[model samples]
Target: MSNGPTKRAADWAETTGFARLDAEAFPDFLPGWVWLVGAGPGAPGLMSLLCYHAMQQCDVVVYDALVNPDILRWVKVGAELEYAGKRGGKPSPTQRDITLRLIELAQAGKRVLRLKGGDPFMFGRGGEECQNLAGAGVPFRIVPGITAGVGGLAYAGMPATHRDTNHSVIFLTGHDASGKMPANVNWPAVAKASPVIVMYMAVKHLGEIAAALIAGGRKADDPVTIVSNASMPHQQVASTTLEQAGAFVAAQEPPTPAIVVVGHASDWRSVLDWYAPALRENPIG
Candidate 1:
């Protein structure tokens, strides 16, 4: 019962094949609006067609640090690109400032694309930006892309859900909005409730988090997998146990934008891993 134009367009696309029409055939998108899009984890090929079309049509793109640079290369030449990335313990733009910038661009009669890494709504703070745009009377659309928890795991050859390992999974941020291990998160409760856990932005605090899980009754030998720079050419994955993940990742010094998966599912990486072959064929050195 959604009456929105985007929904209507999607409906038309599904029923009448309007969505299948190539971007080259469509008219330029209207100005004075914003589209918040998820660019997927890091792979350019994983980007949604709608997201790609929006990038081509937008007058401005305000993107995050995690969005793949190769994907941004597709933007129409001469379009403005702004960086509004936020990283843990880094001097990044405030969320309010980024939201207001989107409003300003829309008011300037620009078709704006607020590009984010992974699914914009999933831990990307896209909802707050959308709310700001809505409050300012800016017409907007949300084009969801693959999130890292799912895509990152795939790149590491670990499924988020498996038939024998787990039926229920939990996804949580390693830190709160302030970039610290959330004291509000009852680790004991979560450890008891969820069999599989996927954490974002937790690399810096892995030691504390691992300790908490162990204190909460999770076994010290529980499987842990850290997939860093997921889906990118330089991607790396480190497999260890709850007691050793902190030390293992620290020793390897993997890059940022990583996803951590914990559960029996992490064990599947031993056999399910396929990225090694691909990497061996295309060695960085």
Candidate 2:
């Protein structure tokens, strides 16, 4: 019988009524096929039921750096684990190699799970991988997860959109492949496009980004919230303004893997903050 974390997780699931769900509702993990699954932001509980189902049956799990290690406990025994994460300024496998490996594994008749953090289609290169799989005649399934921008902001008590604040919200990545601000982004237009903007991988170029938005007509005093390691045990939220964001980041040096929100929507955080206290009451190991 399984012991330790896996056993405890199973017990927790059963207690929470997951065990009562119909098993046949989930699709079979067939051999010679691949499943591209999203692991959610950083919290194991945020994972979808389909994602949990895949974890229990895959023959091999190829996961990313952002995937919480706590989630791996649910994997069935004897399954292989492979790390194929890409961290900025670090040596990592090329995207082509990762895609090719998935194809090879499926071709060998192994049930493969290409797991990624957050929604795979949202700036995760999942579309590219799926394109490659389709070209290779490989069958696959896509299971979406809660994206960090929306989910991470909520954990920080900042809503991506407020009925009273914004009618539309924009999502964008801060950096490009060259580790610099994305060159093709229309800063001024983007600034005017929506009332709220959520950025990913933006901490490194926050200063430049803030300057662009300021130049694009956003007020310097506009609210900004930075949530680091969102939904994780070490999560930290820092509030600042567009004018002070650059200095705030440099002075405080909030940890990376953060989500940055710009707009009046962040003001809600002051009133809606809940996760911090919840963590205090029920801490996770």
Question: 162 in model 1: Cα distance from truth in Å?
Answer: 0.8
RMSD of each: 6.1, 6.4
Residue-level lDDT of model 2, residues 1-285, one tens digit each, is: 645567445656666455555534579999988999998998888999899889888999999988888889889899999999998889999899999999999999999999999999988999999999999999999999999999988888877888889989999999998889999999999988999999999988899999999999998998888899988878888899999999999999989899999988877877998886557443231
What TM-score does model 1 achieve against the real structure?
0.87
lDDT of each: 0.86, 0.89
Candidate 1 has its poorest 10 consecutive residues by lDDT at: 276-285
lDDT of 1 by residue, 1-285 (tens): 656667546656666443456433544568998998999988887888788889888999999999888888899998999999988777999999999999999999999999999999999999998888899999998899999999888878888899888888899999888778989999998887878999998888888999999999998998888889988778888778999988977897767888988888777888988887556444221
TM-scores vs. true structure, each candidate: 0.87, 0.91
Backbone clashes in candidate 1 total 0
TM-score of 2: 0.91
